[model samples]
Target chain A: MKHLDFWFEFASTYSYPAAMRIEKLAAERGVKVRWHAFLLGPIFKAQGWRDSPFNLFPAKGNYMWHDMQRVCQRYNLPFVKPSRFPLNGLQAARIACWYQDAKWLSAFVKAVFQANFVKDLNIADPAVLEQILNDLQLDAEAILTQAQSVESKARLQAANQQAVRLGIFGAPFFIAGQEPFWGQDQLELALDWCLHSEANLSSFG
Target chain B: MKHLDFWFEFASTYSYPAAMRIEKLAAERGVKVRWHAFLLGPIFKAQGWRDSPFNLFPAKGNYMWHDMQRVCQRYNLPFVKPSRFPLNGLQAARIACWYQDAKWLSAFVKAVFQANFVKDLNIADPAVLEQILNDLQLDAEAILTQAQSVESKARLQAANQQAVRLGIFGAPFFIAGQEPFWGQDQLELALDWCLHSEANLSSFG
Candidate 1:
């Protein structure tokens, strides 16, 4: 079996689509995926970016919304433009970090994506997050409290650092050995490399 | 009978893969493609970008190179890093502007992509472009001379201005009426929309 390392940020619009589909696609291809959740905020700040570069450029932002619409239609997924661009992904990322399990992470990601894109909820709001946690039947207070812990903060910082070292500047990135693939659309090709590359395959087996 | 407009830049790496495969894919789906060649250099400059944002950030550039290799491998196409980060696409774009026939533009684009990525030649160089033109059995001097004409230059400018007005900031963008799809990977979805959208398909019949 071959393996793919999936690195994603909760706030990334495109990552939502990829996160929703990657696991199923990988399963069909008989590949294992290791879900790694990280925060892109710190990385962006380090680069002196105030927000997602897409948001900084109005034209790019407009184009992205239209692009997302087309992609969502193709995948038969609902897409509504989020009212807020670059929502605070801290709490969600923290919960993802705390759980660190593939199943929980996947569910959390799907919920967040749906909440932000479909339901148009402000993910940054603790109340909204609490509701999501409650719906998942998880310990909402405990998780939310833990999300603010010093250890949790350090974990996120480390993830950002890891992303920087890996030469990742965008969300929805995948790494197979030294090779890195950016964007959700490249998911299939990235998985293919993991499945066929002798060096990458050996790691999973 | 449905038609989708493909806007591409010769400097775009992923566009190579898309241009090579799109015609066959469109034919299989019984869709028609309209190739729109334009230079992104002016657009980027207009947006106050000095270069491709990928090149502005080292991490992005590094990841993109590796990512493209995987995609090329999956497509079984040759992949090699071009010597120049962003080739001067003005000459090629000018040539494409002269033709409305999709087949000619497609073949020309494929040749230029091969020249830069496979042959590792300097596509920005006039002599190299001359050779490419000669190989294609097109008049090198005449095309080059015509490419310099004010009329051809104005056409290139107009094409770029059209891209910006349509909210496009990236290479390999597609438009189906008012809907826009960015990136080479999104071509299929763009084509699907062209084929399915009542407003667009009506024009075909």
Candidate 2:
């Protein structure tokens, strides 16, 4: 099976749908998914945007909210417009980076998404994160402390750097080999490519 | 039958794919498609972009080219990288405006897309457009002359203003009732919404 790297930012509105369903979808296709937590702030800044384009342009911003609502409805996903746009995901991303290889990584990611998008909670709030960690029976203090360590922080920085080097400008981007697919809408296509590309590999070898 | 208004700019790359297949797809679903030709230059300017974002952002431009290649291959549409990014579509839009409800409107739209994307021809060239019209058995000189009329030009301007009024900031936008769906990927969803929403109307009545 081919592997896919799912580059996502916790604050990305589109990534919520992808995060909530990626594991099951990838498993169904017998493809492996590597969850990558990265920040989109740097990418936007590089593009000369001081803020999310949604915030900079009022019309586009309004359309995005309604568009997201339609998308959520289509997917039957619970959605509540976050009270704050682009919730700070630094802590969540660090934790996700630290737990990259853990079995509970997907659970933590989905929980964080639900917290921000469904519960409309401030994901940057340590107490909210602690509750999520505690609910999962993880040691909140220990993990949070470890996640903030210089080493873990460096790892996330490297991940964001990797995303940029890969030419990713948005969240919920997928990379299978050299093929990069952006947006939650391309999830199915990405997974299918992973499967088909791998199947063609042995023939080439 | 439910009606869908496809708001497209001739210079928009993604609209090439949608324009090619929309007529057939709409006919199959017993839906009517209203083609709206408009200029995106004015809209982009309103959004404070002096040029297409594809040109303003190199990384995104590179990614879009590859992504478009993948999409075209998937759809089995012939693909070519246009020598000029966003070839001027002013003349095409004017002509499309003049023929908005003509029986050959869809044919002309698809031909123009094919000329720009498949043949990598400049859609702004009157000679190129004249050839396309001649091939379609239309009076090339007469129609081209009419398309440049002040009234036709104003009609195209009005069409573009309407797009902005409806909060469209991108090409390949579709509207059903008050709902707006942007991007070629959203075409299916827009069509489905058109169908389902119409079906629900009689029940409510």
TM-score of each: 0.87, 0.95
Name the runs in model 1 displaced over 4 angstroms: A1-3, A26-32, A102-105, A177-179, A192-194, A197-205, B101-105, B199-205
Clashing pairs in 1: none
Report the lDDT tens digits of candidate 2 across residue range B1-205.
Answer: 6799999999999999989878878888888999999988988898789998899988888888887887787788998989998899999899999899999888899999999999989899999999999999999999999998999998998888788888888889888777788889888878877878745332100
* Model 2 chain B weakest 10-residue run by lDDT: B196-205
Which residue window of length 10 is worst by lDDT in model 1 chain A? A196-205
DockQ, candidate no. 1 = 0.45
Please write out the lDDT profile of model 1 over residues B128-201, one tens digit for every residue.
88888788788789988988999988888888778777777777887776667777777777777776677543
Tens-digit lDDT track of model 2 for A1-205: 6798999999999999999888889999888999999999888998889888889887778888887887787789999999899889999999998799999999999999999999999999999999999999999999999988999999999998888888898889998777788899999988888877745332110
Across A1-205, the per-residue lDDT of candidate 1 in tens digits comes to: 6788898887898998998899889999998888778888778887678789787777887666766776687698998888888788888887887677746667877898899888999999999989988898888899899999999888887877877877787879887765677788888878887766765442210
Model 1 B-chain TM? 0.91
| Top candidate when judged by DockQ against the true structure | 2
